[model samples]
Target: MKKYALLILFVFPISRTAWAQSPEVLAIRKYGTQNADKMMREFAAFLAIPNIARDTVNIKKNAAFIMSMMTERGIKNVQLLAPSTAGAPPAVYGEVKVPGATQTLIFYAHYDGQPVNPAQWAPGLEPFKPQLYTGTIDKSGKNIPFPTDGQYNPDWRIYARSASDDKAGVFTILSAYEALTKNGLVPTSNLKFFFEGEEEAGSPHLNQILEKHSALLQSDLWIICDGPVHQTGRKQIVFGVRGDAHMDLTVYGPKRPLHSGHYGNWAPNPALLLAKLLASMKDDEGRVTIKGFYDDVTPLTASEKKAMQEVPSVEAQMKRELGLSTVETTGAVLNEAISVPSLNINGMQSGNVGKMASNQIPTFATAVLDLRLVLGNDWQRQQQKVVDHIKAQGYHVIDHEPTDDERAQYGKLIKVIPGEDGYNAQRTPMDLPIAQRVIKAVQTTTTDPLVLQPTSGGSLPLYLFKKYLNANTMTVPIANHDNNQHAENENIRLGNLFDGLETMTAVMRMK
Candidate 1:
């Protein structure tokens, strides 16, 4: 017999709280324990399909796979929404309305992932090949394993491509439901599902989709099932997420690459020009030098600051893991680090020389920059500061596809294109009744005290659900702290996945 069956025979018979769980919840927990490996296999299969950004064909198959599974599970009201624009792929929308439920909760996640380049992945661990391994990366960057004889935990599941960035959330939610229904637990509220396909591409058309289906997307609250758990391994409930935007700026010079020896002292190097321009945007203290950049940012409330002060800090552990002696922007703790806006150079490139380097002054240089916005900051205005600063530094502002004359005059022109549609940070009032309910529900499922965060440094389109649908949003993330989300060698812990499923089950069964 299965563990759940043993649980029923041995534990449920004498338990007073056994009555607290719905039959479905009880059944699901049992089913999850008995068939955890099978569930992990299904998750691995989903991860195996390469559903990177703009690769909508496989994404469609993956979406269809979700709908098919929902259908086989007897879930109703499943539909595929066509892309709002021509040439865009569709989004799979589904819902299962519970009768007599007054409150509706919209669950959001993306089925898309960032594009992967095979060369960046480790040997024997290609982007599409899912592998299971167990090792804890300690403070010193050393991976300490329980047993180092090539024996991996059979319970742990690791996969490439959005496994934690969101496919894990999808599997956990779906499997939680399956576990519930198979065991006899029923959801307490009317549920809406919004699985987006273009989020990895900054969700360019999400606004149109939301506007088009205003009725279908209606909800009192939204629960984003993205991101990962806090660094302290405590279960977290995030009220908001920071907004993110990307920009690329370039400095232009001569028509062609100049020989360094010939014009070493004469020709102006765009690379050097760009480096100087970027350096001017940030001071030695790491404060952004863009004029009026923080003018509109909302200050943290006393309550928010108090909440942040209570979060655990493993600074030494972090320094060890990163192999760093110290952290930048010191004095304020770890939580304070993510609470503020930040500017980062994602990548930079200009001229390249093979082997024994070329002594050539590059004609042009460009940097891909990402600017994370805090609440109340204007996306367009903040982006403008970077461009305005560049122009203020005597460089041409390439605001759009330049005219022929401008391109010719600027020596091939500087360009600035927005990468991801920026999101404004969100913060739900902890005083909200639903927030309290969720806090209690998560607590009942976890052994430790829950972490209540005002905002996360990561980016999520929670703003859309709140701004467009007038809904309060929250996040219950289950991925481990070191899940390597958005980085190479991404994997999810078996224990975390199980805990998340159990938590979700508890939430669904909450009164």
Candidate 2:
């Protein structure tokens, strides 16, 4: 039989109370142990498929695979939920109903993953090929062979795209129901599973899909299974998620590239100009300096503030692990910082570097800006603020590239292109009765205190669920914090994957 690590040994000891988990919970673990060999093979094969939202062919394959799993595990009415737009990636839907259960929960997780750059991944890993490692690759961990016996080390990790970011969520939710039924533990609440295929693309079609299927998707709650657990390895229940928007800004220089030595210091460099403009958007303390950036923020409620107070401080530990002696916010902690809006430059480009080095001055500088919005912050309004700030800084902001006449007329010219798919932030009340039940359901799986967060720093289109379906949502994330989400060499720890089985099982059986 396989031995599973219930909790990290160094993080928190198992409480006498947690160790006395009910018989149903114990049965769930046993099922995972006794079936690790067969389950691991199925999961590994699923991870081998490429699931980019724009790759229609491969994305459809993923949906078909999920439907097969649902059917084999006893889900009813499994189908692809399509939007009005043709060829858009669809959501896979299925459900399990109980005889007299009045309450229903729609479990949500995205099956799609962000696009990957193969060269950026570490030498030992590839985005599509799933590989096992003894520990984190960054910690001098070595690759290991998959065991043939029904045994796995909780410390081992599986590296692949979507392994943690959400496929783990889809796998866990489906397997949780399997555990319950195979062992004779019936769920108390009706269960539904929704696997979205376009979430990483900002969920551009989600609103339409929800509007088209309002009646079919009705539920008392939407338990989101994305993001990561607490950095301390404790489970977390998030009440809200930040909204997301992107801006593409370009600064114009010369009409053509100029030799640096021939016109050195004579011609203005757009790269320098762009850097200065970005630097002015924030202070040394990291607060966005744009006027009215914080003016629209909503203060936390008394209950929210009290819940925040109880959250364990992870700043010091985070800094030590991240190798930083200073944080951008002077006095605010991590939880307090995420409560407000933020601006970040995801990437910048001006001229070639390294082996592509050249002595010519580039004709333009471009940057991709990411804006994270908290409650009361509209994605459109937040983007406009940045545009307005640029105008106030003596530059002429245009939606199109500057013409020769306009370029000569204005000393500073920039083209500001805004994203069309941006959405605002959403938060469900922490005091809601359903929220309390979600908290308790996840708590039965661990001895450590469950982290109750007001809002996660990550951005999801969860607000659309509220806007289109008139329903509230909460989050129960299962990935390890260092899962390298949306980046290269992404992976999920074996223990987090196993623990998630019990957590979702408890939620499915919640009263």
Candidate 3:
């Protein structure tokens, strides 16, 4: 069995008293250090379980494991909140009510991960078999054997599916609670844990779960532990998240694959048609050209504008790291670009490539489109605009495959399949009392200033929280910005995980 040690490297200078710290912070650090090896082993055990939301059998196993963790920590009301739809993954719920505490805060994190393609992973690493690396794989970081003693380098990273996107959130939140209880430090507010099981699947059934458990989930606020910290390596408190919707588009070329040479000019190429269609949606500068795409975007508030301005300039650093000469010209800055609605091509497919390539035109080409919504946009309306744009391009649009007669009549044939459910964007005021308390709590742990942003570029089903529970929500992300979330070789830096433990502890101890 391998052992790991926890190394504490405080980012800012502080007196000896700072090393002593408050009981909660001190306890978290102590517990994390003393049990570093045990924690790593336990985390590895949890990460080994396949937790794709669509995989019902495996997802339940993850829920059961989490329930055991919470129950062992002496959490009350630890149970699964299942949705009405059978087989849908359930949300694991637990609570720790502090006596005489007036405020109740729900800490949320999803356990399910994005679907994986094993072939896409690096040569030696697999998604579910968590491995320790000296650093990220992109920079020639090599896989290292797990430490046999209880000492670990904070710079080391653990790569596995959901290592940073969310399983990290689950482990950090529960571990923080364990640290508090072990040290006999009672939180100032009542704490509730809600571990979602289907966030990566667009949270299609989250509203159902929320509606069914509204009364039990009532809380003053929800602190979402997801996403990455600011690119500048500082903690961030995001007030909002963009909305999300996806579309599947298929354009037909012929009833059957035709030889490119024999029917060169006679038969149209679906790949070329799909490419042209996608090109029409974006201009040379990468702005979406779809009608009404930007019409619904709401302008930022004065405070939000100030927050945006205060954000450190990380564009140059990011460009250098990403090896990019320039970014999209649509927005003045990365922060501003995320604030507006945008369209993206998640993926596209037409026939095969490489050794499988053939000298024939594919029967059809398909593309998966992602639409990100801002505050004023409606998900359904946003999707409709894209469908309408396709129609305006002189194509015959259908929800399903076209008949032979119809295909023969129309010069261009296409199909658009929109996603079932999509929630709109949600944002809480930055100046709210609860928001300020959260800011202050997080600030206590770090000497550097925290990044306060109006919104994150990513989407969360936070709007459902507002609609069903009317709860004020804020995101305090704790993973490294370069954690490679949702991509192959997903990982969480040991330092980020340790810092997150301290951050969550401080939030629970908020006054």
Candidate 4:
């Protein structure tokens, strides 16, 4: 019996060695490294196109570019779902079906990005010109831009629009697929790719598209290639993503701008009114004051608590990177802070926001509020609560959609235009057999301890695939945590990008 046990232990690593010794996998790792420059150049071309949301013209061009790449790579059945008023920029869809495969995997990613304020870009760094950069800029302190000419440095990375948030992720996924199929490393499961064009704009028509193409979108599992890896550079296999929602509210007073000196004491100040109204939503301690806001927040289960405890101390890391003295909320760290719901004022505008300060009271003030919802919270209902709360505060609410007569008379009245619809949070069970296979495969690829985040602070439309298709969805982000996803100076580390390709290759080949 002792000899039997010894033999079993000896065979374990030998068995793994047999599987890991594939020439295809080794060539993929080698090619990913060797072709790093070529890959960056291709990415630079993709980044050169201004693929911001709402720009249907450029959106289609970008989609066409993706389709063209897939076709050039010999991918079969590539097609573009043309844009319409219902949805902007057609979604890029394609598939590779391997005969005798028992399972199918659907890969999801976004091809669109947030609008960039060109003036915010650094000198010699236009949003369309993808140059490499390093060093950090403190927006509050100083906006200094460091330059790097596409070389790997411990402190520097490639800087460009969509470099990290998602474009890098898409590149990684495609490269992995290319490396596999190119070298005859066929995936064990049938693979399908779905690249959407409206994720940055809240995925308003995604549900409709999903419903329309239920047969084509069906899969055993859906893998979202978005977001960023752990700050420590550990490979992560996330089980879920937190849901999100945004609401724009405004306070109006006199029909037009008023002279501050003339009505200093008597006239109502919309700006001041907006500030006071915003202050009412959250307390001094950062707790939200909305009625029943916390009542429906799903409680963290024992498993989720275990996962949270396993997450590295994000507080110290955040403070060190963000140059913050301390974190907010009751917890001492940022990850803990994310365990609850949050209300943030994303943007506010009323009067002049330029160098010249006009001494006139603005007639209207608008505030864009974003609410990050946790599990067990419904997005639509929660959005309604925000509207109710504003009304409860005794101010007349002006939603974006006005009555026809009101639109004709007011001729562009001060109103709220809902920026983006909210996404519902979702979490998948970690104990599932397929999930276990993925976790084990990731462990085989890297020595870093796997960080299993129960849910991320960022938003993704995971609920749709989970609820509509009954598919198990997971996120595998390739970008570094400090990639500055939505802000200026966005970038992705070449090392991280390479590692992502290796990990993705391993995931695809996992049986």
Candidate 2 shows a clash count of 0
For residues 58-156, what per-residue lDDT tens digits would candidate 1 score against the true structure? 877888887886777776788877656975656677787888888887777788877887787766567777766544322222232233222234234
The predicted structure with the larger lDDT, 2 or 4, is 2
Off by over 4 Å in 2: 1-20
Misplaced by over 4 Å in model 3 are: 1-24
Better of 2 and 4 by TM-score: 2
Query: Model 2, 317-362: lDDT tens per residue?
Result: 9999999999998889999898889999999999999999899888
Q: How accurate is candidate 2 locally (lDDT)?
A: 0.89
lDDT of 1 at 311: 76
- lDDT score of residue 437 within candidate 4: 81
What lDDT would each prediction earn against the true structure?
A: 0.73, 0.89, 0.89, 0.74
- Model 3: lDDT equals 0.89
Task: Give per-residue CA lDDT, model 3, range 1-511, as digits (tens).
Answer: 3222243443221211233355567667777777788788989999999999989999999999999999999999999999999889999999998889999999999999999999999999999999999888888888988876767777788999999989999999999988888888889999999999999998878999999999999999999999999988888899999999999999999899998999988899999999999999999887889998999788899999999999988899899999998897645789888898989999999989999999999999999999989999999999999999999999999998899898889999999999986779988999998889999999887767888999999999899999999998999988988888999989998878878888999999998
Which residue pairs does candidate 3 place in steric collision?
4-150, 4-151, 5-150, 5-151, 5-152
Give the candidate number with the greatest TM-score: 2
Winner on lDDT between 1 and 2 is 2
Local accuracy of candidate 4 as per-residue lDDT tens digits, 216-323: 888888888898888776778788777898877777656678888998877778788889888988887778898988889888878878988888776676777778
TM-scores of all models? 0.89, 0.96, 0.96, 0.87
Off by over 4 Å in 1: 1-29, 136-157, 353-356, 399-414, 418-420
Collision pairs in model 4: none
